[model samples]
Target: MARYAEVVRWPLVEALAAYEHRLREHARRQYELDFIAWCILAQSGATKRKRPPALPTILKEE
Candidate 1:
């Protein structure tokens, strides 16, 4: 629970940071219990996935 702070807190931080090509990549990692719980929660969701509103364009159009 305590260990998932970074992943949950900065879920979209990396994506936003990547546009500048300055994002650092971390090695693949996962927490066992958290992963299992996430899987269960994800499965419990209804069949339809809700689409979020479009994000503002980060980079300028060419």
Candidate 2:
């Protein structure tokens, strides 16, 4: 995962973090895996935000 982290552009960190937060909030049991699934859903245009936004990315660390 560290290798993948290196490839993440700094600007997109917020989008990723936002997805993780949503996962934690709504799918607390398996937030990690759910976050990935949410990304897939959003990317496939199955979610409200066809393209995730960065505003929600300003999440406080847990």
Candidate 3:
């Protein structure tokens, strides 16, 4: 079975880079995408986090 962290990490790395690139091209409002992408990265990494922003609610809820 695939390790869960390894599986999750690949997409996170890709998304963060993509979001950062897109953020530079987008208008100011689009900063939200970059912010949310980072929240996911910081949250999922389970690193030493000091008061990370709350993720925007419910882009896709199960």
Candidate 4:
């Protein structure tokens, strides 16, 4: 997992940083919510009791 993290997580972090940098540059309206707030809202909508479908289950059904 550590090896995977170094290869995968580092690129994801860099991509997200680039995305946020572009958003700051091009967005006309400033975001009312910060990153932490957006993360909380994202996870709040995906609670354990109301989770999204599992990838395996969906693939099997298809």
The numbered model that scores best in TM-score is 2
lDDT of 1 by residue, 1-62 (tens): 78567546765867566534432222112233444555666678843434322322332221
Assess the local accuracy of residue 6 in candidate 3 as a C-alpha lDDT between 0 and 100.
60
Best by lDDT: 2
Candidate 3's residue-wise lDDT over 1-62, tens digit each?
A: 47666656677778677766555555333546666666887878856554554533332221
The residue pairs that clash in candidate 4, if any, are none
Q: What is the clash tally of candidate 3?
A: 0
How far does residue 62 in candidate 1 sit from its true spot (Å)? Answer: 40
Runs in model 2 deviating more than 4 A are 1-29, 48-62
**lDDT of candidates 1 onward, in order:** 0.43, 0.59, 0.58, 0.50
Q: Which has the higher lDDT value, candidate number 1 or candidate number 3?
A: 3
Q: How far does residue 35 in candidate 1 sit from its true spot (Å)?
A: 0.2
Once superposed on the true structure, which residue ranges of model 1 sit more than 4 Å away at CA? 1-30, 46-62
Query: Which of the two candidates, 2 or 4, achieves a greater TM-score against the reference?
Result: 2
The number of residue pairs in model 1 that clash at the backbone is 0
TM-score of each: 0.25, 0.30, 0.29, 0.28
